[model samples]
Target: MGLYHNRPHVQDIRRMKARGEKISMLFVTTPDEAAAAAAAGIHMLSIEGRFFDATMREAAGDCFVQVGLPYGGWGSFNGRPLATAEDYLRAAFHYAGIGGDAYYCAASYDIQKTLADNHIPVVGHIGLIPSYISWTGWRAVGKAADEALALWRHTQKLEEIGVFAAELEVVPDRIAAFLAQNSSLVMLGMGAGPHADAQYLFTEDVCGYGLNHKPRHGKVYRNLGPELARLQEARIEAFRAFKADVDGGTYPAPEHVVPVKDEEYEAFLKAAQG
Candidate 1:
C-alpha cells in the first residue's frame, strides 16, 4: 500500500476479497508470463524473489505479487538457515520497498509475525506443507480428524498473528471450506478445493511442462511439452545447418565479410613483413 502506490497491492486483494471477489493466482518466472497474467486479469502471483526483478514487476503492472521465500532443501529449508525471524523481517521489508505486494513464508507463527510486524504482508502456508512433506509422506493432509483439527488450530494461530493470507495446499474440500468459511484469512487454494478465495498453480504445471505425468490436482490446459520438443528439434536442426554451412565453406559470405581499405591491407602486409 505505502510506496507500492504505483501498483495494485495486498490491500487491493484484501478489499476485493472482502467484497467477495474470485481470483486466479499463478507462479510465474518470466516477464512474458507476467504480461499475459496481467492481461488475463489474474489477481495474485507467487513468484520467487529473483524472478520478480524490475522487468517482471513492471510487467505485473497493478497485480499483487507474493514474493516467495525459499521453501525447501539444503540452504534455508523452511527459511531456517536464511536468517532469524528478524532477518526475514528485513528481507521482507526490502522486497516490499521494491514493490513486492506481499511475502510468502512457511515458517513458525512467531517468524510469520515478525514479518507482519515490519509491515510486510505475510502469506503463510498450511495443509501439506512441502518443506515438511517427509513427515506427511508427500500426500494430502487434514484428512484425519486430529490432523484436520490441528490444521484448523494452526489457522487460528495464523489469524491471531495477523497474517494477510494463508496458502491451503492439498487439503480435503470439506476442511478447506470450513477453514475458509471460519477464518478471516484470505485462503489461496493450491491443490485445495474451490472454497478458497483464489485458485493457485505453478507455471510449469499449468503450461504442461511439469515433470512426469501431471498431478491429479493440475489441469494441463496446453500441451507445451510437445511444442517444446518440437522447438528443441528445430534448434538442433538450426545448429546442424550452421555446422554444415561452416564445413562446406558456405559461411562468411561476402556480405558477412568486412570491407577493408586497400591502403589498410597494404599497411598490415608491410607491418608483417617488417
Candidate 2:
C-alpha cells in the first residue's frame, strides 16, 4: 500500500500478508520494466541478480524487489553456476548491499537456511520448480491429494527454515489457497490461483513478447511481438538504405563532409606533393 510513499521494508511485506492483502508482483529483466512497475505502484518485483544493479534499484522506486539467485547452471556468473551454499550466500549479501529487499533461492533447504541465518530474507520455489523440470516436466503440480499434501509439507519445511516467502508455481488453486491460509510464509503465486498472497507474472508474458510458450495462467495485456517485428523490418530497411547510399556515393554530401580552410587545404596538398 505504501508503493509511492516509501520502499516497503521486508517487515512491511510480511505485515501485508498478515493482513490478508493481495499483492501485485512482476518478474522483470530490464530497468525500464522495473521503473514502470515502480511508477505504477506495483507491490513487489522479482529481478535476477545479473539484471539487478543500483540503477535498477533506483528505477524500482518503492516496490519491494526480490533478487533471484541462480538455482543451478541455468543462470551463471562468469560462465559458472553458483554451485555451493557459500555462493548463494555471497550473492545474497552482494544484492542486499545494493538494496535488494529479498532473495529467491531454489537451492536445498540447508542453503536457504544459510541465507536466512545470515539475516537475509529468502523466497523459496515450490510446485513445479523450473530447475528440476526434467523430473516434473513442466506441468501443473499438486493436482492429486498426495502431491498437494507434499507441497503443503514443503511449505511448512521452508517456513521452519525461516524463509519469508515461497513462490507457488503451477499448483492447483485450491492447494495454493490452503497453503496461503495455513502458512506464515507469503505465497507468491505464478500459475497458482487467486488466493495466494501475491499474484506474480513475468513482464514478458504480460507484454506478449515471451520467447517461450506461454503458461495457462499467463494473461497477455499487450501484443508487442508484432510491434517488435515491424521495428526489426524498419531496422533492416534503414541498414539497406545506408548501404545503398554508401555504394552510390551519395552519403558523404557537402554538408556531411568536414571542410578545411582554403589555405590549410592548399598547404596539405603541397606538403603531400612534396
Candidate 3:
C-alpha cells in the first residue's frame, strides 16, 4: 500500500490532460524498463498483465501504469482468450489490486462498461486496433473523411461508455487532433499525431532492438541492436571457455575442492574391508 501511494492517481492524470499537458508514455515489458522509465520521468506506462506484479509496481515509482487485460479472439492464453466479461472483470481487478492506475480494455464495449461500472479506470482503443488487424491490416486508419468520421463517432461512443481514455493509433494527424480537442476522453497517441494528450511508444522501438520491421512512427533514440549482438557473442565465448576448462581438467584444481583428513580416510577404508 505504501508503494501504491507514491504513484499518480487517476484523477491526477485527468487533471494533467485538462491543463493541456503533453504527457510522455511508453509501453514497457520488463521491471528494468519500468525502473528506467520512472527514473527518466516518464508520465505513463502501458504494461500487460503478464509482466506486471508488485515488483513492477515498485519499479515504476511514480509513473501512472495502465495494465492491459487480455482481450478475446485476438490470441489465446491457455488455448483461449478471456472467454467472458467476467473473465475480463476478474483480470482488471487483479491488476488494479496490484497498484495499476488504469486498465486498458480492447474487448467489447460491454466488457469495458462492466469494468467501468465497478469503478475501474479503463482505457479503450480506437482507430487501427491491433486485435482487429486481420480485417484492417497493418496500416494507418482514418485517412479519408468517411473513415475519420467513423473513428470520431466511435471515440464519442467510448466516452459515453465511461472510458477514461482512448488510444488513437495510426490515424491521420488532423483526425487525431480533432478528437483530442473535441472529446472529453483523454487521447493517447501512437502514430496518430502530435496534438494528443500523450504520446506513446514501445521501449523496444525507442532502443532500436525490435526484431521485426519498425513502424513508420517509431523514433529510435538509441541503437541497441549492435550492442545486444556484442553481448550475445561474449556470452558464447564465455561458455566455450568454461567448456574448455572442464574438458582439460583445469576447472576443479586442488584449491577448488575439499580433502578429507588422513585419519578419516583410513577409518573409511578399514570399515569397507570389514
lDDT of prediction 3: 0.89
- Candidate 3, which ten residues in sequence have the lowest lDDT sum? 71-80
Best by lDDT: 2
For residues 6-75, write the lDDT of model 1, one tens digit per residue: 5566677777677878989998999988888888888788888656667788888767888887643423
Question: Each model's TM-score?
Answer: 0.88, 0.90, 0.90
Colliding pairs, model 3: none
lDDT of 3 by residue, 1-274 (tens): 4543767887888899999998999999999999999999999999987788999988999999998877776544445689788888778777777889898988878888888888999999989998889888999999989989999898988988899998889988988999999998889999998998899999999999999889988999999999999999999999999999999989988998999999999999999998
Model 1 misplaced regions, further than 4 Å? 1-6, 72-81, 243-250, 267-274
Candidates arranged by lDDT, highest first: 2, 3, 1
| Candidate 1's TM-score | 0.88
Which of candidates 1 and 2 reaches a greater lDDT? 2
Each model's total of backbone clashes: 0, 0, 0
Ranking by TM-score: 3, 2, 1
Candidate 2: pairs in clash: none
Which lDDT value does model 1 have at 191?
82
